[model samples]
Target: MGIDFLHKAYVRPSTYTTCIILTFMDQITYYGGLFFMTWATFERHLIIFHSAVFNTKRGRILFHYLPILSIFVYITLYYISVDFFYPCENHFNYLAFWCGFICYMNLPIPTLLGIELIAHQVVPMILIGIFSLALFLRVIFSRQRLRQSIEWKKYRRMIIQLLSTSTIYLIFTTPFSLNPIAQAVGLPPMFTTPVYAKVSTYWTFGVPICVPFVILLSLPKVKEKFKPLLKICGLGRVVPTR
Candidate 1:
């Protein structure tokens, strides 16, 4: 999209190649992140509120490995079916943020608005909020349970991890996702199009760029990795080997 900004590729012609790359990347990062993060939020709930779900090998496979595998397979198939093999012909705007999902516009309004907009995008977004809030509530209530004497340290780490990562979704990605959905539901492009165009430059790919950094920053191991680098640069004192 940097190239798009340099020269309005979204609105320009002969940009099919750029469009394909951007569309593929945008869907994989945005949509793929939605599912991956939603599952991560739910898994945190299980880890904190129902630790026994991971106590056994079977439990780990069922609750952990299987879902991850399922998401990978599902995301792969879903995008390939929708973007690659769908009856619609390619109409790339390589300079655009997603290189255009205009092909989706070719579908019946019901299928496009209902299935693509509602099922794929909205459901996952709703699940994100629900799971996040549900986990928080579970954390609060579990504190009073004798059986759930899970350490505050564990709870604290999980809480911070979720909150920190979710910050990107709230501030950056939500608008990006909502703009299209709102437009689909009859929100005038006259109102949203200009604002989104300006905002999309910063917000379009920013979440994907920032999220991994945020997640890494929330992790203790990432901090440890930084300390060594900092020390070598004379920015911090070295830690003695334990």
Candidate 2:
């Protein structure tokens, strides 16, 4: 959220350094999310469909932490390359609000954009979709002896919610994902005017708001734990009757 704020305030000349910092943070945040989501999809697949393997320390470290660290290192290197070639530039056109103040790279537009679209958007989306579908099938085909059990139902609900959230994230981001292809191919840029940029930017912000809310809502145990706290603050009250 702080990065989002800095991104919004990039119009200020005094905040040029802040904007640059925010740009790096933005790259980290964007790719970090892609990597994490990819890891999460695979993790859930393991936990649900292959618990024996997922439960091991070696498996956890290998599948979980290693991928996260690799993503951080890879994105750090990629951004370093980007900075070496085309340092961040603050642009304040009428489209700045939508287009953002940080201009990443101008020279290697096609090559870099192609790489980003594939790596950050296309590949991650495909992997997530595949793993999520695998999980869905696992839930469907698993033995039904315990289908009525509370734990089994809980896992089923969580899987359904996970699929829903992943679908939403993909749908919301598709436009932003494809928008760069236009510029890469010499078509009119996606954000020609502030009006267009303003309209398109909403997709980018959707995940930040929707994902947390969905997670909280999807977890019954979490909501149950929060009930007491909300009641203490008069936020969740139950009247007593004689």
Candidate 3:
């Protein structure tokens, strides 16, 4: 995000090739996060409620590994086809963010992208909310029943990760997702469009900013991971305080 910002804010008359790189990356990172996180949130159900399904090798592959791999492959192939192979003459606006436009917009196939927008962006937002809340409720019910279905301490991070992820997506991504839907329906372009234009700029920074910290904090022994890098940079030794 920072690299793209620098390219836009500093570099003048950006080339079409650079625009392709910046725009493709911007689309993939932002949408990819939404898709991956949505699946992760839903996968929490399988990890908790459907543990037996993962007991077999086929089950593990079918339930867990395959979906993740599919998402990765799909995101890569879909965007590569769109940005690189799709034949559309692009007019680069060096003054605008990401050269000011998506190529599909110039073509008549933008409605197709809108369907994808809803499928990839809006649907994921809904699923994330539904499943995140369901996860909390189920855990609490299991605790009350005293079933001890799973060891809470063993999987404490899973719950924390789900809740944190839910919070991040619901708060940060909703406005960006809504921008397209708002325009798709009957409405004036100027009403909420300008606000989203500015929001869109900072939206580039939003998830990348929150996700790294969320991930690092969720990891086991995260300080151990960072200490060597800190030492390399001549920061003071990381020590435990009494």
The best candidate by TM-score is 3
**Colliding pairs, model 1:** 18-94, 19-94
List TM-scores for all candidates, in order. Answer: 0.75, 0.71, 0.81
**Model 3 residue 22 lDDT?**
79
TM-score sort, best first:
3, 1, 2
Please give, for residues 164-240, the per-residue lDDT of candidate 1 as tens digits: 77666666756655655666677767535766746754575676788788778878988889988887899996578
Report every candidate's CA lDDT: 0.71, 0.67, 0.76
**lDDT score of residue 73 within candidate 3:** 85
Better of 1 and 2 by lDDT: 1
Best by lDDT: 3
Could you tell me the TM-score of candidate 1? Answer: 0.75
List the pairs of residues colliding in candidate 3.
none
lDDT of 1 at 11: 40
